[model samples]
Target chain A: MTRLVVLSAGLGVPSSTTLLADRLAAAVVRRLGGEAEGRVEVERVELRRLAHPLADRLTTGFAGEELAAALEAVHGADALVAVTPVYAASYSGLFKTFVDVLDRDALEGTPVVVAATGGTPRHSMVLDHALRPLFAHLRAVVAPTGVFAATDDFGDAGLDDRVERAAGELVALLSGTATTRTRPTEDERLADPTPFEELLRRAGAGPTG
Target chain B: MQLGIFSVGDVTTDPTTGRTPTEHERIRAQVAIALKAEEIGLDVVALGQHHNPPFVASAPTTTLAWIGAQTRRILLSTATTLITTTDPVRIAEDYATLQHLTGGRVDLMMGRGNTGPVYPWFGKDIREGINLAVENYALLHRLWREDVVDWQGRFRTPLQGFTATPRPLDGVAPFVWHGSIRSPEIAEQAAYYGDGFFHNHIFWPPEHAAQMVRLYRERFEHYGHGRADQAYVGLGGQFFMRKDSQAAVREFRPYFDNAPVYGHGPSLEDFTSQTPLTVGSPQQVLERTLGFREHVGDYQRQLFLVDHAGLPLKTVLEQLDLLGEILPDLRAGFAEGRPAHVPDAPTHAALVAARADQEVPA
Candidate 1:
């Protein structure tokens, strides 16, 4: 079964980010069709209300029931979607702290899609420099597709088509139809030295030399 | 030696007498602590964000941005920027604005919070935290890099020729360090991007912390970021300092014992010995911290927890003063002793230079 997990970090009720997450999940449900949905169980973990000590390590405590349950959901999930409010131009600390408590390899090999909501459209790079690096460090197979929703993007006047399109692409990526291109293999490395030159050398060089 | 100080943004009572301080006092004291960190020559001050009763700081970036305006040099950061529930678009925009406001002296650590009820409060499910982070960040990256992003993802709607305004300073994204304690997945996430990995080592023992960092360093190299040593790394710790080691332990015991987070658990001594909690003199604190490099290798940042346990702002300020005086020399000494092979902070200039070097001739 293709288990899906949705983690949300927004604070506002009727949050635009949360609405977007629902739409994303719905798109995934739609894309997978009845067959996939029947077998694919979808779960959600919201990290905003877990016990304080579990999230913040200043106090030595185990993961709270909420966080533990969320962790369990993550353990079984095949693909994940995470959303957060943009604060200080990155993921929220509450969100990051929950991530801090998880086992390092829990998300390995799992495909993931990311999204964020903020008042303005300025902090877009946070996905690359902050959030993406966080997940990539966890070893999850993240989709190249991501969605960023600005406060202005919400409401009937906007965001309808963009949400559907982003969600659809995410379904594609999660289903492996939009697999990220492989970095050239050793044989391919030497043959396709043109593109690999900087990346390989900058990556501290592979054994292919 | 990436010197870091984190503020839980709380006030505490005298641990010696088992007294509790007012929350208002704790909030004021956190500001003084950050200023003292700068004076002490710490590299970063990462403020945590929490909306619960005990924690006064709900908006970390607001504080960080304010700190950015006040502090001249110390890099301002958030201990964890929640990506799962918050909008990635807002994150992109706010941080970009922060970047401009701070003259590019800002960066952040991304995280998924622990609170489950927050999901429902925000009208999201508790199930898809990871997926949300993945999809949101993908769009955020495009918003920053591409002048016109035609992006579509599951967690957020697609963008057709959308361009996030107030673009990053010189089109260079802020440097990031992925922080985790137990989660290898977070470390792996950091490594895959060839970015920094931070292990909050205050609670875990040396071996566990070392193992996490080692995994990240190895995977960073695997993901083609850099040599293991060159991978940016950070660590978290808790410390209390006094001239007398006994005085340090004596003074910190009550706070440690009553701390809502760790209270009613392990004896203070046991916890201190088992984890990174160092209740000792300034010299001892320095020695213990210096030892971190032995296990973790040459790391990029080190953050300490000093503002929790309801420690009054005044006391926290004192701790900051002491840390400031001792830390500059510590950082300098570490730099002098560090091996030349280790990588340094991923500063904005480095990002610009790296990208410049990456450009294929137009």
Candidate 2:
């Protein structure tokens, strides 16, 4: 089954960032589920509820129960929808902090749909300059059509088409139309680890004892 | 089971009194604490090693030796001895000297020290922590067992025709435990050598501890040392107990809130739930500690961090007294329904006998 996770870094109770994320997630689900070969599950991670825990993790050097599960879900998903409000021409600190706390290899080669909400369209470059580069560093495959919804664009009719385009790109990737695949996940590596002898050899410390 | 206390040896101001112990006082307090452990019949006394300030465990062997000279039966160990930055030759020589001075009551845990600048300060890099641990420990393992050593490795200068002085006591090295917060490589290293695996159970969630221990045990069995259940495992914990659970909470809350590494992050309530920071009556502490075996299975060595975050030395003494009170029952609980085949933690005598057993005239 394909798992799609949505991380909405909107601080408000009814923030436009979350609205854009929900629209994109729904669009991907609709297209992926329509296929006979596809069975998809969706999980939404609201970053607001996890704000304190994220800060706590920064200080504590470990994730709490709720934050850990959220991280696990995001890492496990076949596709991800990450939306954040643009702040000072960048993704919100809350969004960036969440990404920073995730394991470096957490999103490797996972198809990600990047979205943003800002007060004006000028801040929309956050998708290219901030979000895409961030996920790129994580080795994730950012969907080509990024959906950016400014406050005015959310009121306009053009937002829906961008969401649809972005979702279609994500669905295509999830359908394996794109060859950007993943290395073994952390769980896979842990469950079937390299033999200690091999690791010792790599470290140049053989079993001389 | 070997019940003990492993102190990080941090110097923090007591929030209630707003007074911090001087390094001299803290040092003396730790020595006194270890002596008390021997007096009260606790099995082990371990200290952490840190190169940075606010932590006085930078020279564990010095402190442990001082304590060892005054005590007889109590085992001396480290919460961790930094295997990465410290030269293997030094670890071999120093710990071997300690083994002699302590009269065979010495063991140590290998750890990759965490503080970022500490690596570069020691002419090493943090990125090479796992490598340094593996390579250095390999050299240390050989140095302890072999009469002469010739070695070359990535992180250190090569050694040739060198012998570690004062070879291990009775030709038996102190037992080693590898400690890691979450690194699987360290766990695998521990398994590769059939060493004890120690998980610091107070910082992260219990599930994380269980996962690390599970990997170590499975790899231990894979390495053909013994059954998975028979592998040596040590866990670290924290507690603040009083006769009344509420009083325990009341007394420990300030220290918990401002403690380093995790302070000012999660509330005490949430932190207690996430990690093994049990602050309650002695009964609750015992039950919660005993509950650890449910997940990690029967294991050897249970160490508690009792003297950090500026809890006064007096309170720490009281905590040890309480720990001593429950240790017999805790030992019984750990020993209950135990398989006869599982081995207790190896002591010097046991290692000597095992060594003698391996040598037959055939």
Candidate 3:
């Protein structure tokens, strides 16, 4: 089964950020129809509900139950659709904080579709400037096509077209049709126990035997 | 089971009084606390090392040696001695001298100091913390056991024909406990050497302590030390108590709300519920402490944080009195139905006897 997680950093009920996230999730599900065969699961995490907990995490260095559940969902998902309301020409503080709280390697190699909603089309650059770079730092495979919705694009067909294109890119990556970015396999140098003999040798002590 | 108190040696203002103890006063108070531990029949008095302001315990061996001179039965130890930055040769020499001064009543806990800048202060890097610990401890382990050692490691200068002065008393090295809050490699290190693994059980939830202890035990058996249940495990706890539970909470709330480490984060009530913090009567403290065995299984040592967050020495002594009242019950509760094969916390006398047994003809 394919699990898709939607992270919506929307501050208010019926927020446009959540609306964008829902549209992206729906588009991905629509594209997954034949291959997924009703085996796709969608989970939504509203950062608005986790504001206080996120603050607690910053202070205490641990996540509360609800936030932990959200992190677990994200960690286990096959792909992610993250949408945030652009604040001060970038992703909202709440969105960045949620990402910051995740384990350093939690999102490694996970496919992600980055989207954003902002006041002006000029802020559309946030998808590339802010969101894409953040996921790239986490080693996530970000889809090449990113969807940005300004206030005026909410009800327009243009928004739907962009969402479909981004969702198709994500679906193609997930379905093994598109070439995803490659990451170096995890280092195994530390995996095995350094033989006691080798450790003694490094310490300039001959092997006891 | 061995019962004791460990202090981070912070100098903070008493929140209720808004008065801070001087560095001199705080240092003296630590010695007094150690004396009090022996007087009250406690087993151990461990102090932490911090090289920054608001913390004055930069030299633990010096302080412990002073405490050792005044106290007879109390075991002196470092809550943790920094292994990553400090030269292992100095650690070997200083602790060995301390063991001699105290008549072998010494053991030391190894930890990678937490402050980021402490690394650079000692001309080391915090990025190589785990490797430094692994290498430094391996060298330290050999220095104490071997009369002469030739050693080279990444963190410090090489040693040739080096015999650490004042060899460990009776030729039995002071017991070592690797103290780690979140590192699995540390647990593995302790297991590899058949040493003790101590989890500071006060800050986080019980599950974290359980997980670390479980790993240490599994790896201990993997190294052919013993059964998993026989692995040496020590846990740390924190508590503040009064005759009445409500009064205890009322009295400790101000200190808990403004103190360092956890002050600004979770509320007192929330922190107590989430961690192994008992702020109530002596009976309640005993019950909560005894419950630790349920998660981590039968363990060897139980240390408490009794004097921190600017509690005045008088109040800390009173807390010790309350602890003295409950120590018997706590000890018995932990000892009940404990298996015979499980080892007690390693002590000077026990180590000496084990060495004697080995030297004897089979």
Over B1-362, each residue of candidate 1 has an lDDT whose tens digit, in order, gives 66878866654456666666566555556677888888777788888766665677778777788778789998888888777677778888888888899888888887777778777776666566655555555566677788888875655566788778789999988877777776565676677777787777777667677878887777778778778889988888889998888988887887887886677766787677777889999988888888888898888888898888766667777888888778766877678777788877887777888799899586
- Tens digit per residue, CA lDDT, model 2, A47-163: 999999999899888888799899988877788999999988899999989999998878888999999998889998889998889999999989999999988896788989899
Clash pairs of candidate 3?
Answer: none
- Identify the leading candidate in terms of DockQ: 2
On lDDT, the candidate that comes out on top is: 2
Off by over 4 Å in 3: A34-38, A177-209
Between candidates 1 and 3, which one is better according to lDDT? 3
Mark the regions of model 2 whose C-alpha exceeds 4 Å error after superposition: A33-38, A176-183, A205-209
Candidate 1 similarity to native, TM-score: 0.63
lDDT of 1 at B20: 64
Off by over 4 Å in 1: A1-209, B11-25, B359-362
lDDT of 3 by residue, B270-317 (tens): 788888999999999999999999889999988999889899999999
Candidate 3 lDDT tens digits, A1-209: 67889999999788999999999999998887733586688899999999987887887666767888898788777889999999998999999999999877777878899999988899999999999999999989899999999999986899999999999999888876232323221122223345444443443442223
Q: Please write out the lDDT profile of model 2 over residues B125-147, one tens digit for every residue.
A: 88778778888898899999999
TM-score of chain A of 1: 0.74
- CAPRI accuracy category, model 3: acceptable
